[model samples]
Target: MLAYLADVFSALSELNHSLQGRELNIVTASEKLAAFKEKLVLWIKRVKRGNLVNFPCLEETVTENSTLPPTFVAKIVEHMQMLCTSFDGYFSCGELQTCNIWILNPFMQNLEDVDDDGSIKEDLIDMRHNCGIQMEFTNSQLDHFLASQREAYPALATKGLEVLVPFATTYLCEQGFSCLLHIKTKSRNRLNSEHDMRVALSTKTLRFDAIMEKKQQ
Candidate 1:
């Protein structure tokens, strides 16, 4: 989950960079950035609303589940929290543009430290000015941005968004192996190479079958 959130935040940062690259005037760029931020905030709100009602105590329940260790559940919860907090930071498109302006206009005699929470006062001054008509993205251009974001994760590039399934499944497999080790230690019989080989092969076959079924669908 940490990896997933990292990927998402990284993608958003990349998207911001792309948006800043447009040759539009400051006012036009600011408007586009504001629109993007609004969309992101709406997405976050939708996620929170659904999660609050459907799984109000999901984290606590998962933590208490005996089949899975608390540490693993804690990690998941930590990642979820990171996602929530980071989204709030990223949703401030105006602040993001202000930071970009500081970098591009180094010749400006004075600059103030504009942290994430700072008002985008610099851009607001030119809010009514026309920066000329902004160019719109073609379908191909949009596709390129999406492709670049997904390329950050190889699984996402290959299997698309369903990449999370395999990632989570792999983690679960590690926990299963740990439990198997505990069980083996309790048994009197020593580790049998042949038996272990057969068990591993069966597990691999099952996983492969599942992957194939998903692909077929």
Candidate 2:
């Protein structure tokens, strides 16, 4: 399912890049959108089957892309919204209605105890909002879902349940550096050689592991 999501995201990135400088057409965008939706449905089905639970609902809201034609972007957004709404209580968050099966909501309710300054609460709200807009599940929800799924499909769900947060955090940090390099180098250049990039990434990974170990202690 993770691989499927990655593939869909890659496709979306490709489509976004392809649409740049080209006049956006509904037909062309719709074709890409349809493929994306199909992949999403397949992903959901796989997740549902692996977990032995009913699929969670998904909702997508694309803010207007002014660079593209309004009609074209609107059509794509509408299609995404429909595809997202087709699921059950899987991914809904914030103003988009809560999922009854969400185990993370309880944890989130207790955030006040952990976050006396309220920054964590604010960050969670933002994360939930983004999840709604992107038609993707929250990390909390995903964690709980995978954990529960592990009970039903031990082999399939164990790795995800164990590593979801660490994996996601690592991915985000890597992507952040990737984005920084892209903008600084204009995506047409590389500041470091392949060996240097690997060394830097390895250093970051070791640092993260050490920090996590300290936290656990």
Candidate 3:
């Protein structure tokens, strides 16, 4: 049972890392989450048949003479089912399902299957044919692609933006909290937190050498 839990935690850690990225958008997150839930369903079925392939340590410890207790296997299956349910309850949204259709890669999707009016379908067809648009879509992130298309394809861009703009995880929020903890220490409690936070959270690097040269002049 311990080995089983350890394996489960390992998988969860990977999933958590995958979800925690600056560029993670709803489209990508929904895909990862759906894949994870499918894996859980598979694991539940395998576990019932005494398949310990996923849990290597458990498999190693068990011999042909040894049998897995029915109650223990039942508990493990129940736990996995609960995890699947929790994930479905949290990430299951109609908008997420809709975005899963084509925003990730419009070129790979069938135009007829996309749940949009004729304009979006036209935009997709245009995007598929245009060499420059195809190159941009291939090189840029989904959010960037949608943003760049706003002028050329207003309706498509708007729909994509509705899915892309929302944060997929609480990573940024947690990062801000951690930054605040570092910035607003007891010694610096009375200091101006706003400016300090702005500097700390900024992705831009300050050029100290340039600043020094200007100061000397």
Identify the candidate with maximal TM-score. Answer: 3
TM-score of each: 0.24, 0.21, 0.87
- TM-score-sorted candidate list, best first: 3, 1, 2
Query: What tens-digit string does per-residue lDDT give for candidate 3 at 1-217?
Result: 8887888899999999999978888767877888888889888899898898877777877888997899999999999999988887878633445534787687888766786654888888888889998898889988898999899999989888887899888999999899999988999788778888887888899897998999994
lDDT scores in order: 0.42, 0.43, 0.84
Instruction: Give the lowest summed-lDDT range of ten residues in model 2.
Output: 52-61
Model 3 gets an lDDT of 0.84
Give candidate 3 regions above 4 Å deviation: 63-65, 93-100, 115-118
- Can you write out model 1's per-residue Cα lDDT over 1-217, one digit (the tens) per residue? 4433554566567655554422323334445656655655554454444332222344334334343345654554555556556755754434334443432232241345433443333332232132320121122343232244343333222322221112311334554576566546646357654565455535344566777888994
Residue 81 Cα positional deviation in candidate 3, in Å, after optimal superposition: 1.9
Model 2: per-residue Cα lDDT over 96-196, one tens digit each:
11322122342244443433342334444454555442243444345555565454345434543433333311344555578557444656465555655
lDDT of 1: 0.42
How far off is model 2, as Cα RMSD? 19.4
RMSD of each: 19.0, 19.4, 2.5
